[model samples]
Target: MESETIQEPLDRFLVSVERKAFVMARMATRDTDEALDIVQDAMQALVEKYAGRPEAEWPPVFYRILNNRIRDWHRRQKIRNLWRGWLKPWSESNDRNDDPLEQIQDPGVVDPGEGMDRKASMARLEVALANLPLRQREAFLLRAWNGLDVASTAVAMGCSVGSVKTHYSRAIHTLRQFLEEYRP
Candidate 1:
């Protein structure tokens, strides 16, 4: 019975976070498969390692684990790219033809034109976010998208509060500049 009590909230928390976490990971990785794997790994790590913590502490702990996983993925990609460069220097191509925007849909929307406008705006935002430096992007997403406070964001990012503030401020400025034309 006691175990059931503990498991219930954790299950609820995971379910609540899963979609947002997947979106965050997808934005960071720009690869659907990689993002799914990262979110799954983060969820597993949180359940295995931090399940005993108070519910109030779960957000920071889970996000910290998720961000760490994303960072590790970036590191691994860098190493792979380095080796691939050495092995096939001439074949390197940065072009990606897939349009991720086409995959996004909102079935609940009643108007197709409004939905297209929304999707276009979201695509521009995503591109601006993708262009941000990793630390700035992490800070922005954790604070803005995840609704985490400054201290919680600091904890999630494994950075000082001041660093989180600085990164987030820079991210906001850069994003505002990038999306200026889209503004009404």
Candidate 2:
């Protein structure tokens, strides 16, 4: 009974962040299935390893687990691709339907013009973010999108505060340059 009380907040927190975390993972990996797997693994790791920790510590710890899982996935992919490179004749082409990140047009907006324009701008920003270097993207998303402070983001990224600042600053500058014409 007491354990449930302790777990309730953690459960709520996980629910709150799950979708954003999956989107972040998807954006980083560009592979929907792998991103889903990574998020699941991160959540499991957080539950198993850090569930007993204070709630205040949960966000950074969970994000750190997520970032580490993403790195591990990328590392495994690099090795697999290397082996595939040596045995290229058996390679199969990917089907287009497997992508889960495709943006769907919404039908429920009250103001179609405003909603369409907003969606278009958001799509462009998403593309620009996906094109950013990994560290820069991570910094920007953690600080701006996920709303983590510099110290917390540093903890999550396993980097120093100065590095977070530098990465975040560079990311903002790059986005401004890339999306200069996206202003409403």
Candidate 3:
């Protein structure tokens, strides 16, 4: 049998969970490149901020950074969309207008409807997850997918445990509603 020993436990821990984190990021962002970027940002944050902390605490801290980055990413997207919407009415003229804001596409954003390659169940689950409210998705994905405890989920989400529980409950309820007809 070949031994697969990672040098440090921290390295091993990060290696073990990185793929899941990427998946979580992908599910949140709905863009592979953006998801990869988010995961990279999260890794940088984890290394910078939490490297000195205990290894066991890394999960919560890493996810907290990741969740925060995801929030920031969404915020940036909203702002960009808002600007684009506001500018669209003015920029329809024949006058040449070159603005850097217009030139700057949101980083790592892929074209929409580019995920047609996913298998049926994965695609359905992606839609259901996407339909979830941000907080509900955060709660469910953190608690259910990441295997974080309620307290850890709260910490990652920057909310109270009660809020986490509420979001998770509502997420479960909503998901059941969404997927009820698809039961096999």
| Overall lDDT per candidate, in order of appearance | 0.87, 0.85, 0.77
- The TM-score of candidate 2 is 0.81
Say what the RMSD of model 1 is.
3.7
Write the residue-wise lDDT of candidate 2 on 1-184 in tens digits: 8578778898899999899999999988989999999999999999888888889889988988999998888789889999887889555645444332354334356557988677766766787888788889989999999999999999999999999999999999988876675555
Summarize candidate 3's per-residue lDDT along 1-184 as a digit string, tens digits.
1122322765777898799889888878878999999999988778766777777788888888888988999999999878987879676544765532233223342433444323433445567887678889989998998889999888889989999999999999988776664433
Q: Give the TM-score of candidate 3.
A: 0.76
lDDT of 1 at 132: 82
Cα RMSD to native, each candidate?
3.7, 4.2, 9.5
Local accuracy of candidate 1 as per-residue lDDT tens digits, 37-68:
99999999998888988999999989999999
TM-scores of all candidate predictions against the true structure: 0.85, 0.81, 0.76
Which predicted model would earn the best lDDT? 1
Q: In model 1, what is the error at residue 30, expressed in angstroms? A: 1.5
Question: Between which residue pairs do clashes occur in model 2?
Answer: none
Candidate 2 residue-wise lDDT at 21: 94
Give candidate 2 misplaced runs (Cα > 4 Å).
89-117, 181-184
In model 1, state the lDDT of residue 33: 100
